[model samples]
Target chain A: MDGGGSAATIDHLFRRQHGRMVAVLTRIFGMHNLKLAEDVVQDAFCRASEIWKVDGLPENPPAWLMAAAKNRALDAIRRERTARNFAPELDRLLRSEWTVAPTVNEHFGANAIRDDLLRMMFSCCAPAISEESQVALILNILCGFGVDEVAGAFVSGHAAVEKRIARAKKILAASGMLFEVNSASEFATRLPAVQRALYLLFNEGYHGACAETAMRTELCREAIRLIREVLAHPNGAAPASFALAALMCLNAARIPSRKDHSGNLQPLSDQDRSQWDRDLIAEGLRLLEHSASGTELSQYHVEAAIAAAHANAPSTEATDWRQVVSLYDMLMQIQPSPVVALNRAIAVGQSEGPERGLMALDAIGGSERLARYPFYAAARADFELRLGHRDAARAHFGDALAAARNPDEKRYLAQRLAACGDVSAPLQR
Target chain B: MAEFAYLYRGGQRPSSPEQSQQIMQKWVAWMKELGEKGHMVDRGQPLEQSGKLVKAGNRSVTDGPFAEAKDVVGGFTLIRAKDIAEAAELAKGCPILERGGDVEVRPIMQMNM
Candidate 1:
């Protein structure tokens, strides 16, 4: 029996239960004491870890955690000072002894959990919150991630993420966001922001600058989990959201081959196709088909189509490069950005010659945004290497190395640069 | 055998899944070692930081025994060892130290009826 596996089961359950538990507790504790509710949930995890260490795994872990948290809430209410600080909403509900138990029970009931979680999720990503803050709020409040975990997922430094989340939480607390279960129209208006946060979450998981592979994949799994929450609700599953989920599914399917056995980075051109998760690819293809049902052509739809082309191919050489290039074209038409342009150039390299790809890259070089981007220089180096421009490849790789965020990337670029050694050296003469 | 309290202090949670797992494995191994040596009284409970201290006389409440994170005693463990030195020796095995935490080993007092 693997202890690590059991530990992972506990971790997974925490994520699954944390949001629902927080939602219900928030309803009982009131909006003002949201931080207190979070504290109680953290306490529950501590209790679980200790008890499980001694008695082994419980028969029903979630029930155990809920009961522990409920008792803690009771203890808090018993305390005069804390109870007096409850928001008016909760204070009124808890005024009488007769109403207190039933009120807490009613709020924590199974039926209320799902609705509460949905409402809280919507509240976290409300249009008023900034984009990055919204993502941090969802991860911290809804997903039960710590500041460190949130930082790791987003590839942001810890101190910055801590401050960002703190500011976001203060704003949310001040907003006194009511837990209104939104009607379809209200949900429709806010779905885009929620989708954007989830999209960013998924992209960070897929393209994280983080050195650790496990941490990166955990983010991807979390994004998929949260995206499922969006799709579970009938009105919340917009076509664009579905497209985004399909895009994640396709990208995630390739995760197994993304790193080598020694945990170094593996480029797509060298990755083992047999290691690709076929189940995830099939699911992704299914989602892609579903996404096509609505006439709305989200950038995600185009991106997912491009990913599907890659997933369906037997090998890099066998990939439908033309299809990828066209989808990228569509993506550029919808969501024009330096990153999109960079991706298009790479596909163009595969479809046309390396020279054409270099030209496409040069056209986008005018953007100040791509100047510091390591991947832009890295892409240029890849094309130059293919075209036998050893000196140019070395220079571009050096630029990439200078801009690399993590040691893994720098090392990879260094190796690529070393491979492009000059035949025009004095030693060769 | 005598009981001692091992007060845990100052360990940040691991920033990554891999780091957490590695830390957990060390903890599990240490616990197993204690159990094998018949020194494990109980695995111990982790304490949450939010607590209101009941004042000496007026019964006014102020926030927490340790207001700042560094001064906070995160949790305590009760373990049986032959002597204080043995208990202190046991603290050396604590996994939290790997993450820059410390263990304060103090002997427990017993009273006769």
Candidate 2:
């Protein structure tokens, strides 16, 4: 491990350390100086890179970075703070330089870091902040995601992410909110937003917003890790959270088989069943069972059940399509949206028939956003192709190809378009 | 043509991962431009704040190379140019300057063997 020290080690340490470091530093410096906390953590990494280039990675690299951050944090406080009782939390050890390291250690210790990360997540997902900003803050501050990544997640530009994060920090600073652990009641209000952000994070990774070269399993992993952290806490665990976790697990299980060799989005039908992670599916099923005890079903519960169905099915054709369609029906009742309708229509085609699916999609029409949704048109083309309506399939495929944003998607649509081409030019034959 | 070193200095390092990545992209693009023009003699790197400084003819080794944070040279790049003016012109597109920083373009004097 020591001899084979690579950038991968630092990359791993960076993801692990950044959020925890920011959290502990935020606990000390307050959210008002969260930027300083982040800068100090970043500086520690820069220093580590320089030193490690010559000295090799230290025996305990994470500990080494933590020590550097601790020193930098103390230096920041001493230089910036007025000669007053700035940190009342450290009144016990503030008098002595010897205690400074101990005090910092106490906050940055594993258990304390875990607690701080939870608190930081809650603070970022504070209901007061707008939902988008909450997500941007979590990705930027906690998850170590770059602006490009977040913006890419958004399917938007970097400028918007910069502004969103800036606005989020402003809200956090001015909201006069304590970064301490939230009360059971307070956490109850915040949990929904936190769960929403986490789910979105997972989905963004699963169905990328850009032409991502890599799968970004890290994002999905981080989302699951945070969800688990929340579920581990007494205040945070609820039926909904467990359901969300179950959904994430079920989806993540299939992530390995989501893409083909050419980097095209592999339909569930075309995916290699052998590549699916059985252990993950088992865990997800276990979590889904636990969620069943709750009186009221959340959207997570509905979604997770659908995912579980797919996970358990031996093949896509053998799946309980009717059950999936029913789940989507429930979902529509709970949260009716054009996207849901589009998904439901495809599922309906599997359960019912292609013509019925086309009818459902036709009903879902009107929104410009849905009109531009590649999946909606692709699904329509798929249903049309199934029903032997070659011209309609070709027309729908044309729309799908035009709407395709990424190369894989474009390639997939091109193939489908070519399939329709033989029938589309029947007059030539 | 003369060789020159562009010493990049004083830009406040980004406080967040997102910001740092954007800054990194700009630098890569800037370096790519220099590389494409065949002006890049050496693709230099950003420096950390910590380094030992040996003074008094290498007799006294001090703790650091920096007197102040802002005065620290963040990175340097070697390039070929006609003269100091052309080197300075090449430095004009430096990414650090977009942030609060300046590029010190100095000609590499040709020493006789």
| Best TM-score among the predictions, by candidate number | 1
lDDT of 2 by residue, A317-415 (tens): 899999999999999999788888888988888888888988888888555778777888889888888877888888988999999877878988888
**DockQ, Cα level, model 2:** 0.10
Candidate 2 residue-wise lDDT at A167: 84
DockQ of each: 0.19, 0.10
TM-score of each: 0.84, 0.79
Residue A354 in model 1: lDDT:
91
| Candidate 2 local Cα displacement, residue B59, angstroms | 17
* Residue-level lDDT tens digits of model 1 in B26-68: 6666776787789989777767767888878899988776555
Best by DockQ: 1
Query: Deviation in angstroms for A219 in model 1?
Result: 1.4
Q: How many residue pairs clash in each candidate?
A: 0, 1
- Judge candidate 2 at residue A3 and give its lDDT: 18
